[model samples]
Target chain A: MTVLEFDRITKIYNVRGAGQMKALDEVSFTLESGRTLGLVGQSGSGKSTIAKILTQLETPTTGRVLLDGEPIPRHGKALRSYRQQLRMVFQDPFASLNPYHSIRYHIERPLQLDRVVPADQVDAEVRRLLERVRLDADSVIDRRPHELSGGQRQRVAIARALASRPKLLVADEPVSMLDVSIRLGVLNLLADLQREEGLGVLYITHDLATARHFSDEIMVLNQGRVVERGPADEVILNPQDPYTRELRAASPDPEKHFATAARDQGGAR
Target chain B: MSDALLTVRDFSVVYDVDPPVAAVKDVTLELRRGEILGLAGESGCGKTTLAYGVQRLLKAPAVITSGSVVFHDASGADIDVNSLDAEQMRRFRWDKVSMVFQGAMNALNPVAPIGRQLEDVFEVHRPAMSRAKRRAEVAELLEIVKVGAARARSFPHELSGGMRQRVMIAMALALRPQLMVMDEPTTALDVLVQREILRQISQLRHEFGFSVIFITHDLPLLLEISDRIAIMREGEIVELDTAERIWTDPQDGYTKTLLSSFPRLTGERGVVVR
Candidate 1:
């Protein structure tokens, strides 16, 4: 079933002298439960606008966001409940986490506030959340966010997101700030969690390489429009849009790209 | 293979803390004239420390414990960078060697227009130049980075992040130094912007024939751009090899792991590369 659907969503921003700016123009997509939809775009491509509208941090000028076949409520109890069902992970893990709080505090607070588990069972749920994200619950439980590595801190952030048992997760460049060596471990962890929990996810990133690896379906955003959308491999390997081709060219995989270019030059010779 | 433009020998830097942490340890490397030498490492691996140590840019608690940095000028004279007098060092910095510092995009004076900021470089280095000459040079430099001369009058806030970075690159190239030391220049930029900046740097290097010490944690990017790459780990140079050799047959276990860390779009998906 489709957990989240964006139906002709359009967002217009009014500048003092510049008139109306259509940040997202009739963007339509559906994210099924237990699936990942990757939004690939460069800066100022309005990728974050979609995230904001879904999270209800910003309102769309036109159209609607449907959760489980129902239009998302705008205010009061319904909006609060909708937020509990949807969670977000930001780009910089360091900025999102509280340095003063312990790991247990970060995770347990969410569980308690959301009442995801019974009061008596909150501790067990916190432990499970930590361990589920592949962090050592015992050793990591007492440490502060600053004490952990970039990767570990990110896992803690993921754990906090999972505490509410969110149905749809909007991870915005979730692992962009992490070291390359530990990036895959986090991606793999996310992939594994998506499999086991059957959660729908909107994975937003500037990196097509990671997007191709992680997402089931990919949508290429150019100047706030869906320029291309298809299965991950098809979009990446056989991209139809010129912007997608430019992105593929700009991706930092030098060996394969250079080798192909060299071969092409040699063949022409 | 070409003549060494700069040579660092037995360099070490130690922070004067309680335990006195050695941020850079007994390291040695060389930059060939007109070659792009890459320094690759994770954060706190002392790659930045090494770059700062070579140019005596380290401040406060960080002290150069040992080493010699010799710069071979075009006139075949060996000048020790370590023992240069204060006045000589000041002139030597932007004239002989300039550094594009990390976050240099935001390093421009917030209150000043880009034109005046560009002219400030000439004001300090080439003090004899008239106002007209400085304006012309600034315009030419802006053109080199493709920012156009109109942007010279605009504040840093007027330019986009990529444009700001291009302005920084233009400012760094204002004096046309023999060597440019860039520390994590494009780390904060998105992939496309980073690619464009790297391409411009490559083109500018080709046009001017100045050597570059490009430092970054992204090994793949380094492999793509550099003639030689030095891998640093825990303040030590673990492996130094040609970019081709480093990519094809890396000797160190750490280098191999670092290379595998980045996900490849074309290769086997969702598997640990090692």
Candidate 2:
């Protein structure tokens, strides 16, 4: 089933004196349940604009976003309901979390505001969510954002996003700021969550390697248009577009290229 | 290779917090003339701290406990960067050693034109140069970094992230400094733009004959661009070897794990190997 769909979405930003900037032009795609759609693009390539349109942070200049075969309302109770069903995870963990609030408050505030559970049971639910994100509830429940590592903070952010049990997750460059050692762990966690919770995810990133590793379907965006869209492996391995090929070639691979160079130089000479 | 441009010997940085956390511990490395030494590690591995310590860029509450950052001047005099006073350090910075920081896209003054920023670098380092000479030099610098001279008239917000980074590099290279410290110089850019920037840096290093201290968490990028690689873990330098060796024969398990964790683009088909 199509959990979320963007039908011919177009967003234009107009400066005071400058002409309109076409951020997203006639972009159309569908996000099904229990699947991830990876959006790859360079800076200013309309990936973030799509995320904004879906989250209702910004309305599209044209077209509409449908949730479960119905158009999302512009205002009133329906809009709030749509927002509650879709949650966003920002790129920077440091900026995403409130520095002053403890982890418990950060996790529990969303639950309380959304009225996910009774007031007294909010604490227990927060603890369970923390555990679900693989964080030790006892050690991290009272700690502030500053006290935790980047990986831990991101996990907490994920837990906070999952607090209200949203069906769709819009993670924008979620692992770009993290260390490589822990990046895979987070990606694996997201993959596992999608499988277990049947969540539909729109993972936006510029890193094609991670997109190939994580997403089931991939869309290559350049200049606010979809250049190619197919299975993640096919799009990565046999990319038809010149931009996708260039992006693939530009990605650094230490094991293959470096090893080839080493062999040619007779083992670093 | 007779005279090393920058020598970091037994360097250690400690954050004077409640537990007195050590960020960089007993790290030692050397950068020869015209060579690029890449520092590769994950976040919180002290690579940035080491970069700041080399140029004495650390703020208060962060203390350099031991060792020295010695730079060999053009006249063959060894100067300890850690011991320099505020005024001396100011003169040493940008003139002798400059840094192109991470997220250099946002480093520019949003309101100021790019030409003025480039001119500011020249004005601080070469105070004797005339206005005409500075303007001409700014154009030349921008051209060398592949950012057209026309962009010098535009504001920071008008330029793309890659263009902004090129402008930052142009500004850093304006003085022809002996050593340049780049911390994740290409992280803010896309893969193709990153390649272009790295290729420009490689070519410029060959032409300018200046050593580079490159810090980044991307191991494969470091392997591609660096002559030597230093792997840091926790707070210590776990392994330091040639980029080729670090790729094929890493000495530390942490380094090995980091290399393995990277997702390769060209590999076994249809398998999500992480």
Candidate 3:
């Protein structure tokens, strides 16, 4: 079993005119192969920073990320292996995918790069990966990203991430770009894959409802600080920090009937 | 006299391609006086197409096939929108109806200061207004959306995503138009900011009494703010009713599926998706 530990990571970005900005501050958390951790925050709350740190897109200012109690390799074959173990599913599938390439080429690139299967079996594995994501392999494999719907394109992206057979998946707002009707579908597909494959997932999003529902644990971030972290229900239903509470109040609760329709609409918020 | 602020009959938008795909097929709708009407649908379901068609904002390749849009002015003047010429259409747009689209960067000019851009709205629409009055109005519009007046000096790039969206909203509100058609205005914003913006929109409607066509794929948000909701699917409006009814007892099977798409904060999760 794989255990990833993020130890006291701090990332400070040197903004063009603003000099320096702390994107993350002394943030630390543990992710295990069999569980999911929801990283919840607003746009500039440093949620993406954590994802960047994990994927090695940005180096930490003062801390380290350890996989199985060892520091991650910086470069060469070890770095490639580290990447194979940790994969990312970006938010915008439309932009993430290339318009020119067919879906087969997109998924095949990852499989070939990782050598997930031999030459002759590559075609079969591509079909299998597409099927695993619950997409109709025959219908979509030959089509370009533009030909597919937002949901279908996202499913293909998930299939591509799973192509590496990673131990961990860093999904940064995976469904936020898709239409609301199709968001839950992509999310459920991710959750099902996590359950079936025992892949540790860092589900990063500004949405609390989905986080509480899908994650085993929820970590709240505010302006680069980890304000609260606990069991998903505890963190969401009974938030300790004011930031989390504010976030909860802001999110439109589908079950909470708005008394605005009844009254003068003063407290619709 | 009808209580309807706007009436649309037999509206359809067809793209001129080989087979000629109908993006919006005969969508008949109405906006009640001073009510927030929610247009909910997935992407490519023709929600945007209907909004664009209503405002006559749609350009070539996509043509309005069979439709009539009539705007019922509060002064008892009924203006048939489709017959207006270019100059008349321009004057009618911001003066009678304003639209906030996705509420993002492309909505504003990156080169000019926000203050100048807001002033330009008055210059172009209300040509005779004094410079000082335009500046004061810009500040007031900025205040209404809760953005600091200091942001007026900054360009679009200098402002945060949420701030830029609020500025777009400020621009939309400048004309005091009878109808505001906002297409996914808060979709890109964070949840906290989104709620705040919605609250502002709701409050502003109460204050100004301008009717709104709030379009988004987010159904729950529609339930929160909209008095009535319209559900569109495959270029046609399948269901249109009070928001409460849409939420509690969705009649159409497609509406039921759309309602069940979101993961609820309470109760059993994913009634359909799971």
Clashes of each: 0, 0, 0
> What are the TM-scores, per candidate, against the unseen true structure?
0.96, 0.92, 0.95
Ranking by DockQ: 3, 1, 2
Better of 2 and 3 by lDDT: 3
Docking class of 2: acceptable
Give me the overall lDDT of model 2. 0.89
Angstrom error at residue A92, model 2: 1.8
Poorly placed runs, candidate 1 (over 4 Å)? A258-269, B272-274
Of 1 and 2, the candidate ahead on DockQ is 1
Best by DockQ: 3
- Strongest candidate by TM-score: 1
lDDT of 2 by residue, B47-135 (tens): 89988888889997899999888898988788988889999999999999888989898999999999999999878878999999999
Instruction: Order the numbered candidates by TM-score, best leading.
Output: 1, 3, 2
Per-candidate DockQ vs. reference: 0.54, 0.48, 0.58
